[model samples]
Target: MGAKTALLAFTDGDLRPRLLRPVRTNPAELVRVLHPGYEVTPIEDDDLGENTYPPYDTSYVAVLEGAELFCDRRLVFDPPSRLPARVLEAAAGRRVIMHGMHSVSDWLGFAVWENGDLVRSLSLSPDGGGGDNIGTPYEFELPFWAGERPVKAPYPLPFHPLVLGQAALRAFFGFVNEGRPSPDDINPFEVALHGFRVADPTGREQAEREAALQEFLRKVGPPRQYKV
Candidate 1:
């Protein structure tokens, strides 16, 4: 079974704590309003087929290995583990929505944001038992941090439930648990969220989206222009 998750990033530039609202648009309505298309998976394995959701036309890429999708909005995912790279990259430098379903081999998480600020980031993976990450602000590292992302042990591993300093814990996860760490504070490279369960729908399509958005912006300067 595949892991189903949708991470949405917005460009509104607010990072506050707010729950992701559910998708109000109906699937049948989506099919009627937009044309459907196909997108290939980012996995190295060629055996996997294409992803048929999002109608393939509403996808957007924020950066390399990062997907910034607004089409998903607040759609609910069942056991979400796989998310396109474009969506993950979108989470940084903007307001975003990330949700993951439980899976043994994949990272499962639920993180909510208010505007562009973080609120709660919880890891639902059972891999490390109860010691696994339950709450964190995992969304902060999505921006293009300047450094070589390590792929081995000892070095920082992305989304590995970083070691929170006793003093800093109150600000991060909102609570400090004993037996964790009390000395030095450190971070983990959550680049793996960008690497794993990712897909590449199309670079050309994303470019087109950016162009379309630009054109729309040019026509209407901002939301105030459309106010009645």
Candidate 2:
């Protein structure tokens, strides 16, 4: 349950099939497509087999057989419907899938779009309750929404958001980050990705962002422990 992801994909169709066969691509070119005017410097080769989540000011990108994926924590939005227009434009007329989860906060947000139209988008956590729920529930989400999977007693939400979070990963992306892998599951390790140092031209944006995070952490202090 400690696993985390910040993944976005643009695919012609099902990404799973395209992921099965790894394809080499120009990481720089892919980054330009997704990032546009951002300053990008090649850093190293990364893989989706692990570490799909990139750190602040970094991104892991890949142009697969028929899919393109970018991993960066900054992609996780409170309500996935607010995904930047530029990013969505990269997949105009194709299917776009976004999967974001933070195990520390037990938060999950995901969305899917086809042919420039949103089909489903959701964000929820026990602490924050539901954020945005648009469109009808997909088939894979039925069981959780139907109360078939209930959280243990003393929990606020009916189901663990992370549990359903993992389910959404497998359903939308054909893999699970924190659960037992199925034989048919895509071996994320086999998927090749390239890493890059992405930053604003002046470096001021990243500096200010880090400063804000530090201030927030200082105010929050140390983590508190609780017992059942």
Q: Give me the candidate number with maximum lDDT.
A: 2
lDDT of each: 0.33, 0.84
Clashes of each: 27, 2
TM-score of structure candidate 1: 0.26
**Model 1 over residues 115-135: C-alpha lDDT tens digits?**
435555454333532222323
Query: What shift in Å separates residue 29 of candidate 2 from its native position after superposition?
Result: 2.8
Cα-based TM-score, every candidate: 0.26, 0.91
Error of 2 at 19 (Å): 0.6
TM-score of 2: 0.91
Task: Kindly report which residue stretches of model 1 are placed more than 4 angstroms away from their true locations once superposed.
Answer: 11-95, 102-107, 130-228
lDDT of 2 by residue, 40-132 (tens): 898888788676667788988877887888888766677899988877787767899999988888888999988888899999988899998
